[model samples]
Target: MTILLSQEIDRTSYEPAYAQLVNILQASMATGVFKPGAQLPSEAQLCEHYKVSPMTVRRVINILLDRGLVTTAQGRGTFVKGVDIGEAVFHLSGLKEQIESTDRAQVQLLEARIVEAPERVARKLELSPVDWTIFVRRLLLQDGTPVSYHRAYLIYDPRRPIVEGELEVTSLEGLIHGNGQTDLQSGCLSIEAVTLKEEEAAILSMGQGDPAFLIDHTFYDFQDRPVSWGWFIWRADRLKLSATIGNRPPQDQQSAMKDSRRWTGEDHE
Candidate 1:
């Protein structure tokens, strides 16, 4: 596709020229003017097109590269690395349950295991360094098309038979809460826009640097104690998040309780 330069360059502005250039490039990507793998105009070409210095154009290219929106080869030209618009649909449920409810996707469990939690995982789950965790990893498919990757960490408890059973048959969180061991209260969650790694992209059937929604969440018990922590990656093009916000708290706080198994983060709240 040919790169078009329509707007006249504004000589005086608070924003730097490179910043403006980045914005234009990003807008082009969003509008599909420049599709993924499409080579961008050379720095010299951009300099002439935007009436900017070569240094300025180079800086703009650097910004895109840092954000994982573009790649450059020494002899080859720069290319678009797919655009991520931060679209994600999150719910107070595990990925399996969420996808199943959609009735559009069939989830496939790729792997599952019990392992020692890393320091970050240990801190999030409030488990001791020596404590173990049941790590559930899986791939989700929509009509047999891969869409997401999930990794869940639950505190190790040998007594819970739920861990030993098939996860497909039982909800891990439901089983944990049903045991009367923990009463889920509330949770904290966070979401951010990210570029998928090569392996992650492969799993999602997308290219590296494709847009993805990185969701990090933590579940808490009735006493406001952390129960589980998880990370999920969803394809941006396939989902969008929606929520109803109210200034006042719910009429019945007890009845407004959400699922205990789902991760809650500030982004979702």
Candidate 2:
């Protein structure tokens, strides 16, 4: 508790007492004064040391809980939470941008041709099985090591520029953000753990039946119509998703909402 007492709540500042206390505790944690899993001072101790009421200390604890900075047990006191890397947010653009940001990243076009829409893909894209669709496959690599295999089925539209640029990795951004053909209104993504099949294994240069991640994506137009559908198979060790949590300004909240809408296809009027 000596470390916690080194920083006192500012009494004269315009900031609320609770806010100042929170900053003190947060700063202590940042400096490793309060290591992960360390128990915080008891409510009585905090109240006595800070000269604050029990309600204020409780409120501070609640705020810490909301920020995911601490956890509480029924019988035990609050403790600092250990950072868990697996607790991360998944974002489509984030993943794409991360791969491209790598200096040695490369994208190789494997196949691009018209093919009859598969029943599942047709249903997902709201197309008939008899309709023709553009089938595109690409391999993503980093430093010459295969990382992901991309397979997509797009609605056949010769007039759209997306079809022409679909063969290039740069155009993948157009597919997500939209090309002149149709602006991307929204989209949804699903990911699951899967074992690599023979073909998938060969493409990723991994052993057959190796663990991998399968991400399915579906994009829609402003009309709420499905425009494109595809999946990306990634090596298990190649990707890790992360996101910011806790308080944000109104503008930042709005921006996060827009990103959510783009990825989840949630229509917000």
Candidate 3:
């Protein structure tokens, strides 16, 4: 099939041709320019259109394969994956918790193993730069449509075999809590706006540079030690987010005022 590419890779920049091509293709797929089951342009066509080598095209194709964006058949060319949606998901709990509560949500584990985390993630999980961490990657789907991508990092317990003990653990927090080592009691989570990268765009079937939510969450054990640090990226249009805050009791408010007055050296009597 003859596919039209809207953007060209800047060869002068340090970014490689394949990476740029991946980004371009991801944007097109996310925007529904190419629907699922639609055949991607042949390698030779991509090479000609992008003015890059066939090897570059293949490399980019491999990335899309790894990301579960497109599948290649033995005799046929690669085609986009299907993304079907139903009623959108709303949020009151964490992603895993939300998935657990929802009846129709299904989890597809992409990768799960022990791996070394990056600098910021390492710091967040209170692990040394070189320490190995348990990494869990999965996709949450609702009605056969991928809704979010979740990556969680946990401090690997050496004595306990986490994989064996928590083989059926559904949630990241549950994975830690069920280990019989420490209970994850609470989480501190912050949500911010983020632009979907090429890889994320491909995984979630959204356009590249699309608006999404970057949820950074840290789970704390009963002792208040950070047990895990997780990141979740949800497609902007795939979910609606809401929160509920209750009013503080009058006694709690009075106590807060008294504490403030005591700190400020005001008359407490």
Candidate 4:
């Protein structure tokens, strides 16, 4: 879209010219006229386009740079960096525990019940149609602010009665370990950005078009048998994710510490 920068700037207004310029550019960005990594016009081009002085344009660009909305190269000119919400860190834990760690949120257990596994779930858990599972639904809050809705399912074994009760006190992984199931090992997770559906938005206390992070996690035992599966839908505005990718855990363990420190700095920054 061709934004008429000059027309959008109100000359009679009390706002500074640079501030007005920033506002114009921000509006253009919000409307999708400018995109991430898209090159912005040079200072001279902006000066000419807006009918403003070169210094005024530079000042506006500087503001955007500080906000991490754009980055400038020595010779290539300015480019949009998009809005960096900063680093997001996520931990695997029960809904209540995770929210409590933030100290800014609360959690409400919306529903907790045991039910027969659906066909898909039964297949994933490698269970018969008669097998049952515990379904727990919860809402997460931040500083008393509602943020996300989550649902988790664990295959129920009659032999593991302790596992059922521990769900209320510990994370799935923790409960598994407490049950003397230390043989449990790692599994894969998939994450994606999505827009909330109408029903999801109502339960999450968000608008229908609001952004969300959908995470699908599957857990397995040392024998590589799927043990549990969980689905979480988190508000994009409230949560952040952090992950570490590397070679398998080191054998020396000492080297792992050094590697962890290095990656932590890079990831957090």
Candidate 5:
């Protein structure tokens, strides 16, 4: 079980050895020492070398597994995952255009229909308990490979005509903007790591329990009226987001300040 690794675990530090092992392996991967498809040291090897337990080894492997950093074969061993572009931080805007600009990227409408608003959707839009809304589901692709699955529920006004064709060809974000009445003012967007469920995995062409990003967006209008929002699930290995960390433009800053004032007054948006 004993094997030599030049960079041994720091037993003195408070951080668990398993976590440290993850960092070491990540550094190794970044430095090309652990190339894609290369098998990592076995559990016993890690245990003996790090003076740790089998449980600790398992934790390390599981962390790597969930992050899509490594994969395993039934009786074989764990191998590093190969990824083209992975991991990103993004602002609320420009998400759709970013995906399309990638090579041969396209959007495919999976389902679009008018349906009664679920409680959660109603609460987000601040609608009555029993209300109607448009449900839109779509898939994003790169070179025909599924990258993300997006589902959205919007405030549906039955009086307005539904344009199916335009909805299919345009990004949901763009479509919402085109309405003109629904001005997306400001809200929250959060991204979290998630284990894909059976249905989500099937749609993303990945295995159940595979790693993915769950992005939740909640936005209001200029008048602070909650209108529509989207929840997007993205494959960890295929997608990355980027953000600019700077002050908003002057006009946007003014708008944001106004939004903040409006938030304290009424729970409209």
Candidate 6:
């Protein structure tokens, strides 16, 4: 299939052609320009379009394969991998708590203050543009190494001791549900891939423009009103997320498997 690339590698840049191509293809995949199971352009086509050597294209493809983003079939070419959203369900949890189980982890509260809400944060937290919110910044360290950073904005309530509550695990209750709090009621989470900026990289002890995972979460009350919004920036090398797809008893699981086989005609033999 013929593919039209919207961007090309800058040969004059210090970065290699392979790396640039990899990022381009990754962006294409992220934007759904190249849908799942769609065949990537042939090696010859990419080589001609991007003016890169076959080795460069091969290296980029290999990198994609390592990331589990694409697969190459012998003689058939490469195709994007289809993702099943139902297969992975990440729970709402703190980055510090998530890494503390297996590693010696610590969280440092860098800053906590009431600040004018950014337009994006105001929109997310469902607050007016003129409203002020509590901004909290934290750094998570695993085994004494910085691994993740967090930035949160909470709805300001004068009755709630937000700064102190923001420091403790149970404090999320106060921030989310307002003054008298017990536990988390409900929330939402989103994950995306991002590159570190100068400030973020410096804080995380990573190189500027390095890849990382951005986790955005919003907490809501029983009334379904948005209470808080925040995001965590985690080093890509330090985190891995997985989930079990289904919950079934042993007998039920076996029966389901057999039914699937019967439907697929595998039970005929």
lDDT of each: 0.68, 0.75, 0.72, 0.69, 0.70, 0.75
lDDT score at residue 5, model 6, on the 0-100 scale: 85
lDDT for 183 in candidate 6 is: 34
* Residues 52-90, model 5: lDDT tens digits: 899988898898787667888878888887763433335
> Could you tell me every candidate's TM-score relative to the true structure?
0.47, 0.56, 0.48, 0.47, 0.48, 0.51
Which 10 successive residues of model 6 have the least lDDT summed?
A: 242-251
User: What tens-digit string does per-residue lDDT give for candidate 6 at 17-74?
Assistant: 8989998988888788888888999888999999998998999999888766788998
Model 1 CA lDDT for position 69: 74
Q: Candidate 1, residues 57-175: lDDT per residue as tens digits? A: 88899988876678899888998875354523335343444464446656566776788988989988777878888777767677778877877787666754433332422233343
lDDT of 4 by residue, 1-269 (tens): 23454455678889978888887786666566677778777888788887899888988999877755688999888887654445223454344344556456556788878999988888877989789888888776767777777787777887755454436433533432344545446667788999999988998888998888897877776667777777778887665443332111214533433433223345555
lDDT of 2 by residue, 31-122 (tens): 67778889988888999899999999999999888778889997788898877655545455446664645477777889888999999988
lDDT of 3 at 44: 86
Highest-TM-score candidate: 2
Off by over 4 Å in 4: 1-102, 165-184, 241-269
Ranking of all candidate structures by their lDDT, best first: 2, 6, 3, 5, 4, 1
RMSD of each: 18.3, 12.3, 22.3, 18.8, 19.9, 21.1
Top-lDDT structure, candidate number: 2
- lDDT by residue (tens digit), candidate 3, 141-229: 87788888988877776763443333334364354234455345667878899999999989998899998988787877666767678
How many clashes in candidate 6? 0
**TM-score, model 5 to reference:** 0.48
For model 5, the stretches where C-alpha displacement exceeds 4 angstroms are 1-98, 159-182, 241-269
Better of 4 and 6 by TM-score: 6
